[model samples]
Target: MSQPDNPLYKTETASYRERWIGFIHGLQDRICAALEDLDGQALFRTDEWEREHGGGGKTRVLSGGRVFEKGGVNSSVVWGKVTDTMRTQLKIDGKNWFACGLSLVIHPVNPYVPTTHGNWRYFELYDDSGNVSDRWMGGGADLTPYYLFREDARHFHRSFKDAMDAFDTGWYPKYKQWCDEYFANKHRGNEMRGIGGVFYDHLRPADSADADRLFSFQQANGNAFLPAYLPIVEKRAVMPYGERELEWQEIRRGRYVEFNLIHDRGTLFGLKTNGRTESILMSLPPRARWEYDYQPEEGSPEAVLLDACQHPKDWVK
Candidate 1:
């Protein structure tokens, strides 16, 4: 809910930003590479966009792939004088800020392969003299299944919990709960967006040594993305699905759309900051549906997914 409070080591502020930009861009490439390899038939289209203010980002979108229907891997390195809206939202008195991050969303073609999303970001606020007064890191990964798969959910949750437990034994459970709460669609009966994963923020460094520790933690989570989601996708991508399954997927995607537009802070931030609208909305599915009085039959797989959402599980346990 809150942001990070650690200050960037000031001795090499420019160098740090450079390194972060390099890492994020590199992450974007590596993830795209993996997706391209997995997809085989489709390739990602890259768009390098410049912000109106002072920075730019590379957006890579893959569609109609062998496995995935649509996916986006994007990285942005931007900085500017904090706007009044940002000042109000972030509640910061700082004059300027810098942000760099990589975000990704993968929607597999088959309903068997659950949709997945993850992001990792670094941010800083600075004074007039260009000294970093505050800095932080935030992100997490989660899975949304049209057909609930217990093993898949457990593996996804366990993978992130391992990444967090390596840093703090308490972080896994704490942030696992945070994710469930944070990604909910409150207007839709408090249903979760997905099977929960560890979500953390305001990871402030207590000392200089702690900064490196947090960075490594972020890298660990980011690197673990493939392992967490790929196996499930590989198993399910080629499984046969009929129109009924596809219909449920689209219906579930309606809820995904609802959560993003109605509650996602990322969408709000991007729109408010005048960030590229296309790239921000690339998270949406290629197709979705909303039907009046739609209801899944009891004891059906679709109903099972809804039941899971209604009553979240402790996947790792």
Candidate 2:
């Protein structure tokens, strides 16, 4: 969206940009620390990189852990001139564009511990004079469990729902539906990537005060991630699993890879906009397999997981 013709757009201050950047950087530190503590045997290695066209980012990855198999927590602040590709693909108009966000994906060693993804971001479209013509905020967190744990699904959804209810009770349901729809393999009969969590985007604030409110909302969701996920990890990480479970987990991870590579807007957006290849694709699992015409036996645990993926259920009333 563009509003270069509107004189009022120039009056808006961009102070929130710095505040958001600060919040995400701090969040990266906290999350990395917590994950390291959880693994107790692995540490995240940091890679600070600069974008050739404009801004850069910090990428931290952990692998070969006691708990986690592979994980990446990344924060990026990037800016560049609006290009024809952006106009044609992203469908937004601006002389310059700025975006800052934090995105993460965690894959545990145990198949029982669900893989999770979370993102919180802000975008600004600047006019020819560097005035803010349009701005908005977006992002959410979701769960992708290899094995269906109804209680874990409820816990993940309720944690985010509680965070959203503090602002607007309506948000959790709306975003939950969005998450279900957004993270699906439409080509594969609309099967969901996971049970689902909360997702929202294109949140444009009405005023400076409203901007502050949205910032708090984003922060609430960001803060909710640990509590939403870590307890479930604690409960499941030590559960006994065999070759059968591991095989199913890898099979399911194939679908996760399919969604991210094919249908994920964030991944496509990053690659199209000259974003770092490694950071953008870090959401993929360390291992995956696509077995042709795979099917689980009737009334089995794998069948249960497949049923949930095909038909989403309300995790919280």
Task: Return the top candidate by lDDT.
Answer: 2
lDDT of each: 0.85, 0.92
**lDDT for each residue of candidate 1 in 1-317, tens digit (9 for 90 to 100):** 01232223332466766777777777788889998998898999999998877678999999998899999999998777778998898576587777889989899999999999999988878876667788888888889999998988988988888887788898888888899998899998899977777677777777668877888888889988888988898888888989999999999999999999989887888887888999999999999999997999999999999998888789987
Error of 1 at 266 (Å): 1.2
Please provide, for model 2 over 155-272, each residue's C-alpha lDDT reduced to its tens digit, 9 standing for 90 to 100. 9999999999999988999999999999999999999989989889999999989999999999999999999999999999999999999999999999999999999989988988
lDDT of 1: 0.85
Output the worst ten-in-a-row residue range by lDDT, candidate 2: 1-10
Clash pairs, model 2 backbone: none
Candidate 2 TM-score over all chains jointly: 0.96
| Clashes per candidate, residues 3 or more apart or on different chains | 2, 0
lDDT of 1 at 51: 82
Cα lDDT for residue 129, candidate 1: 66
